[model samples]
Target: MVWAWLRIAVAVVGFSGVVAGFIVNVDRARREGQDLGLVLANYFSLFTIVSTIILIVTFVIAGLWSLRNPGRSPEPRGIALAIAGITGPILLLGIVYNALLRGLPSEIALTDPSGIHSLDVWATESLHVIIPLYLLVDLFFASRRRALSWWSLAVIVAYPLLWLTYTLIRGGLTPDPSGAHDWWYPYPFLDPHGGGGWPSVLIYVAVMLVVLVAIGAGIVAVGRLRSRRAAARTSPVGAAG
Candidate 1:
């Protein structure tokens, strides 16, 4: 019960952090004379915003459901697992990219080009760090167990594929605002004109695909292990023998 409330509290704060960061970004963009469409077009900002919203809604619903039916399982167990599976990789992607490839905000302001507020960094961390950690903890250690299938990993990967496809199509059509290239790729590595060409982009994509697969495998393995342990504890002594 205490853990349930803690999860709810964390979800609310995490959601608020993402929203705050988004507001900062939007406000800064407006001040710089950038349109709302361009601000919203950013993949990181958009993904974090949507994912946090999902966390908020799912956690709140689960918490309330638990309260109403104290001994029963949480409602929408499958959806909760699905949300965790999808957002877990995304959170990792953001953290790894920023920390390793992009450098920290203290080292270099990653949001400088985007004109987002300073506090947006913390907000970004909330999505990529806090919320992801919270979800993993809740999924593994918290009550009201749920089982996830391996096939759902395919479902999780489908989203990023669609996002990449959209990004590529849009980049080809839209001109870069920075005057650096004809196409507008969200990341420099994805830009054919500036990112060394299709070969470079393909290599990066391949590496990312491998990382995504690993993330999926890890989540599934941990989840299945937890499920099996729960099953083992609950089985009758005669059946176990």
Candidate 2:
């Protein structure tokens, strides 16, 4: 559908922007002339930690609300759970790992010339990998409403995808030696020269797209199947009663 394709494209662009923006700003902090390292570090810390915390609370509320109301609101419930379940955990993991694995004291974050820092890699991938999966589930559930179409699905998927793409490109396009060294698992797809070249990253993207779409289709099938079973269960029993 036209809407579905548009939604998918939007997600791709959004993903790229968020990552890329964060990376460029991080580099700007490290550059000798820009030595806004102290200022930017403080700002980044302020925004990143605070925003992540806020998002966790946001998803939790959404999850709680969805669970309280079922049946007629099944589509909304699935969508809420997708984001709350995935993003919420990723945020929690980042907070735990950043504070625990990195040995940062309470109320502190460490950022230095090592590009950004290891904690960032953990947080970034944790968020990225999970989001696509969430979008996949949302598309499936949303498509069932008669008024909606496949295009609606695509539009929804595209939002986060695009935001993340922006962020990733902003980070490493110039090919920083230090950045490459600091890069972590699962996200080497963003490495300069595409690492094994653009082909590698493109393959990764293709795979992600397929997995996301498949997961959505599966969700849609399951929801429909369950609905049918519920209807059957209710109908005959109503006659008997």
Q: Could you tell me which 10 consecutive residues in candidate 1 have the lowest summed lDDT? A: 102-111
- Candidate 1, residue 148: CA error in Å? 1.9
Instruction: Put down candidate 1 lDDT per residue, 113-172, tens digits, no spaces.
Output: 654545676786776777767766766677765667787678667766776787777878
Question: In candidate 2, how many clashes are counted?
Answer: 39
TM-scores for every candidate against the unseen true structure: 0.78, 0.43
Candidate 1 residue pairs in backbone clash: none
Report every candidate's CA lDDT: 0.66, 0.43
- Scored by lDDT, model 1 comes in at 0.66
User: What ranges in model 2 sit over 4 Å off?
Assistant: 1-58, 66-152, 172-186, 237-241
Q: What is the lDDT of residue 29 in candidate 2?
A: 49
Candidate 1: where are CA atoms >4 Å away? 43-45, 72-77, 102-116, 176-182, 238-241
In TM-score terms, candidate 2 sits at: 0.43
* Shift of residue 25 alpha carbon in model 1, Å: 2.1
Q: Mind giving the per-residue lDDT tens digits that candidate 2 earns over 126-224?
A: 344443344444434433222223334453345346634654554443223234333222234444455587677667567656654554444445555
